[model samples]
Target: MRNLDRRLIQVVPSRRQLEHQQLEFYSFVHFTVNTFTGKEWGDGSESPSIFNPVKFDAQQWVDAVKSAEMRGLILTCKHHDGFCLWPSKYTKHTVAYSPYKNGKGDIVKEVSDACRKAGIKFGVYLSPWDRNNPAYGSGKPYDDYFVNQLTELLTNYGEIFSVWFDGACGEGINGKKQVYDWERYYEVVRKLQPNACISVCGPDIRWCGNEAGYTRKSEWSVVPARTRETELIADKSQKEDNESFRQREISASDQDLGSREILRDETDLIWYPAEVNTSIRPGWFYHEEEDDKVRPLEELINIYLNSVGGNATFLLNIPPTKDGLFHENDVKRLKELGDFIRHAFAKNLLNDAELAVSSFMRGYGIDNVREDNYLKYFRTDDGITEAVIDITWENEQLIRYIVMKENINCSQRVESFRIEANLGEEYKTVYDGTVIGYKRIAPLTPLVTDKIRIRILDSRVAPTLSFIGVY
Candidate 1:
């Protein structure tokens, strides 16, 4: 147990992925043809005459999103119905054909402009399944068409922060499945917005195997990396079959790809994180009947704690009404949630705690540490699997939230950890978990203590922590 020279396997995220993890929480704008048709999956036959947003206001959308403290918004520029919000030369089913603004107003342009004006990030969701295109099932011809449309969006929109995709594939006009050219799509995003992340159906970010806005207690961002060839074939594969190995589930078994253990023989480890998506309403599209069903402020707070707090980003859907504006109830709920979150985490209780580590690497001592500094480290040894940080508070304080972060530059190493409060001479365990990637926010029952301890029970290698905060 004394081999001190051992090095843990390294798993680091790309620059774009790092930026995405920092966002933590954002909103998804599912406004499109489906909003008017009252259908989650709209057929390609929807006429342009019905697509109108008389009182459309992009600034209002930004106001709602900003009020929620969400980092940005992701607009559904197009859905499965093959309708486009922006005028694209590749198709006639766009805003150009719609009577709104005499076909001159571009939803994408307005939203992007509003996001820039509001100082928030902007993203786009372009569904790959086109039920209207006749060339969809025609192999190369359909791929060419899809790429051209993608190019138009990437080039026209001002600096998109994320390009999202959905794996909703279906038979086309020719009664054959249209093959998606995912690699080509990635290439286009990289060329146009190199800093943007391709989310969910793409590589940089992945779906959490469920759309219920919840993540597992032990969600790890490091997973096996797949080549371009494997990615192309993965979309069409059945999830219940061998494809299950490639997919990451919220409550996946310990042996799953994103589980705690390393699956070296199966796939090379890479930093592919999870994204939890759920709508604010009962449905993704705004419905008149569901107006009163806007999720309560408490529920959204819980989701934010679980998703954004569980080392994964939360993508909450807040659909716009057919009149092109967020519902009044939804806006109020968002503001309430944002206010609660900001107030709850306004100050860190452990900011001035006398922090001490059981063992640390040289040149990584903790003194006058800031919020995001990575100078603190507990270098791992072959015989050592545990490290402890004892914090002596200036005064006994009641705290309900504990935040932990790993120096992901060295990869996600902590597999299991625990937090305890010292009561007299005895210590009581308050919280424990399996992984801490970029950030892990654990909300516990309020506890009053003058001393606290963090113990790393298990790790792939010696672990390194960037920050530990209590609020």
Candidate 2:
């Protein structure tokens, strides 16, 4: 085990940067031994032969992710109990030994292929602790074994978007240290997926220090001005002053603390973007007994606002069952959730309003503005919409184009809309009649003007809009 040169940790298109672009949306696929026994795998002890999934439909999972507008998916290739989803040459205790379909299928491949087809990025969750493998807690030899398993995962999988490592270190066999070479792990990932973002214990980001998702309204005060590597280490003596410590490297926090409750007040100490991960059910795995415990759409929406809308990325865990398939209840709820999001912000002046830009407006394009700053104009009940935008320049210049984003809420109706420039002296009509939600109306391009204003006309009801950009 070797320590990496702290100076070599250069930031590329890291997780922080990707998050800034794709704002607050990711999927968590919790699939492992927990799905087979209807019990949580605290220590990886489940038999790999039980990994059979007869009617697994990877496409359905991908479809759910795309419909939900999620940018990435993190699969539980190996849980704490150490059961591997894909067959590994390093160990026989994997899907290769599973009883389902006589251990002949690879759940990881199915997911990766489906994600590629759906145009969604893929990531994997590999737990460092393994209660199932006797060698896991057996000291140095175990560390070597662990590295081999990781190498198998990295080399076998195609381009991974991320590799999530949880710091749930368990006791080694006979009280020996479970010492790990984190630098080696980081190097392996860099070699396999050059652009992937490592999570929690890697170079790019660190855990949120706690797994609670809820944060106070003023939590932004806790976020560090910039990420620093020094903050990644957990010092028992500095626990009280963790908030005061600042670092120069970017970091991220994860929250899956409770079943449905997010401790919103704890967000005050977050230094970087927080991630909220919760399962669709009470447990992270699919349980026949918990089949009726599907989370209601309203609860999901509340979680979305309190987490994703609260300036954090939301990681909703949708676990597949022993049959290697998402429960019907899970599927229906995902679709319902997607529809709810689509209808919440559907209609706006940006969608149908005419665009007029002043000839003097110059040096401004959609790509030039910061995403969070750009999203400030549009408002939604849950804060997910970004439908309307206003721009003012120091000098008049020619404007290129105005783009009205598609509505996330697709069920709502828009009655009418109006766009007026120069305080209503000159105006152009955008939408004059009924319009369904989720569909993009039209774009107003090459509008040459300086000052512009917009108003929703005769619209009593409107869906929540995601975004509106002016350049």
Candidate 3:
């Protein structure tokens, strides 16, 4: 494969760019083997007949997504286990053979139609590794089969916002390389859904180069910077590039690893604006045992703040059951999360005097606070060591407590810290703790005086501390 020349590429508004501009969010409908067999779909083999969503309501799903403030939905058209959500003309192992609706309904079509009706974007995830297809192992033929299936998806579905092709390759039945004609696939997509963003290995966006939900302090926007340097680079490279070489704008996607244990090293390789994909349940798929595993509203808010607020988009997965139904618990949690997010951030902090950030002490870091300028201060022998910020009000405004925030770029341990108001002569020690790695901090407190200052005392490692803001 030839490297994409940054020059000849016209900066197009990718799906991600559109989403960002629209303040739109996404949903990952992870329904497949995991929903049917109550097991994760990694082995790539499952009975299509087992695929049934009796209560499947594409409109309802779309309505829920819209209600949740999401702009796009990505259905798991075909998972790694190779079960097709639609009745594929290329394979018998699909919803066409399923007992759901007597195998007469096409889930992808319903979803696409529903999304269009709701004026939202539609996308699909087609796993490259087909475990059940007998020809999957036959290298040359498998490529053809894959293309055929791709054609079916692209041609059959409505205008797709994205064609999610994950890099999950495995040995076919004949034990040959799972070779894929990506160029052919791209061509098909271009012909069908010309406006769609081909994800991961495609021309537009990459996989953060990592799937971790966490985002770096400095996130790259999907809208490529139209600089003279980029243009010159692209021109030089594209001149020598071949026809097979596709030139696409840069983009990124990300998902949180659903482990309870927090990642120690918070440096996620995924680029921003990364999409944080987390499930409402313990697993990505639905299971009887996981019916009660819905994530709490507060926890979901934290995820949103850290993910989307941290300069990454949030892709919250809510899997449907085998019966093609969302669990009541899941629905409740989703509603609660939506309500909490609106109530917390949507409300003007200037009006509500209830919101405040108490401690700006060491160890605590601010994750995502909006800023108009980059505040650089206190450069160390190595680099910048610490930063202090203060916000004051002139009149008695009906404002809530002030917020002190700092963006941590690298892993560091804090020794001590203090927060002081301009009112007092001496600084008062508000919070003192240890912040381990790269993370944003948001400290809330009761409304107090407007003037506030934060100071960091010590650190084990040094990372770029972006800025402090009062929100």
Candidate 4:
């Protein structure tokens, strides 16, 4: 259409990105030395003896994650403090020197094996900034050390789904920040874990601009290519010497990242989707004071909708307690969340409704919307961005929620749309939305209606919608 840059609708996600998006919700296990110190960031001087989780149960962690209806778990194998959960021969400041299992336990292996047995995907997060290593801040030596640690995790883990990184660079043991060999780190991941998607500071996924559980009203997957580089650089610049782990997230929260106006002059375009990460508690690490402070059910649900249901996937961080187990309070809220979701979408109210579309591509049909085929979507003819789909049933059906999905494999073209319900004589807008990338779970007030219609108000090109649901 126009070198794939001028035409935003033609840009699509890579295979790795596509598969990653399919995992709508996942868990982020943020357990490290920080869990013991009651601090968010450790200074890398903590003793290995303080690292033991005597009652640690990896299965308990995975079980709690599964109960929440999450698809995967990304463990903080090592944090910025340079405390490796796995026993690395390269560093004495690891679980190897810890008191757990008499200095022989490997938390990484335990969690990975538990995940494999539980039939859930496992991923790793190895911080690039190793404050405990003397080689850091030294040229090639630090790069070699980073590669060595990364290779160990990839080679040992059964099937790594993602490798999460952040741009938290601080003074190393030598008092100078080490220049990360970003390309080489990505290459190591590619060579060992061919199917894994590198996230945040890597290629496949982007951080959703904030860790406060906030999401853009219209999240776009096809942003300018420079976003990947500019964001990492920004993280380093916004860092404070006292708070080595925090970054200013709201500053990057732009309202229109991939609008037609923004992409018209861009030289490059990429399918860099955002991953909305937020901790269940106020902080990423467990503190006894925050045990009663687990996120409320309603707050978690809103984040789930705005993230996994928005254009981005949700990475909810559930930090483990000092005992290395998910707190009972956290588990209770997770159960409530899972039960609410399963019971909410238990049935699609539009199942038996008659379907009719105003227009469709030559080979497609209106019936495709009712089918479970994700690829077989109902798309409007060329240049016909505005369209409609009407549904009716013999008796009034109660619908509390509406779901819409764009066939983003063809690129996210649907910009604005509304779902209307005919409560009595005329139709009324129940929900209005924008940017239905991947998935959009729109909630509505409980209403009884036998007839409903979807109106596509605008789009950059002919709109393609893969799914619609009434719940």
Compute each candidate's TM-score over C-alphas. Answer: 0.91, 0.64, 0.65, 0.96
lDDT of each: 0.80, 0.55, 0.56, 0.86
* Residues forming the 10-long window of minimal summed lDDT in candidate 2: 1-10
Error of 4 at 136 (Å): 1.1
Which residues of candidate 1, in runs, are more than 4 Å off?
A: 1-8, 226-255, 259-264, 373-384
Clashes of each: 2, 43, 20, 0
lDDT of 1 by residue, 1-471 (tens): 122112224568888998898888998998888888888778788997799999999999999899989998999998888999999899899999998999998999999999999999999998888888999889889889988888888888888899998777877767888767788888888998899999877888877766666567777777766622334334643222122333234454422555443454544566788888888987778889999998888888998988888888999999999999898999999999989988888898777688887776566654423366565544644446688888888789888888888877777777789999987768999998878877888888888899988898877657777777788
Instruction: Please give the ranking of all candidate structures by lDDT, highest first, separated by commas.
Output: 4, 1, 3, 2
How large is the C-alpha RMSD of every model relative to the true structure?
Answer: 3.8, 13.0, 12.0, 2.1
Q: Which ranges of candidate 3 are over 4 A from the true structure?
A: 1-24, 42-45, 208-212, 221-272, 349-471
Write the residue-wise lDDT of candidate 2 on 331-401 in tens digits. 88888888876755443223323433222113333322223233322222321122233444444434433
Comparing candidate 2 with candidate 3, which one achieves the higher lDDT? 3
lDDT for position 23 in model 1: 89
lDDT of 3 at 180: 61
- What global local distance difference test value does model 3 have? 0.56
Which 10-residue window of candidate 3 scores lowest in summed lDDT? 1-10
TM-score of 2: 0.64
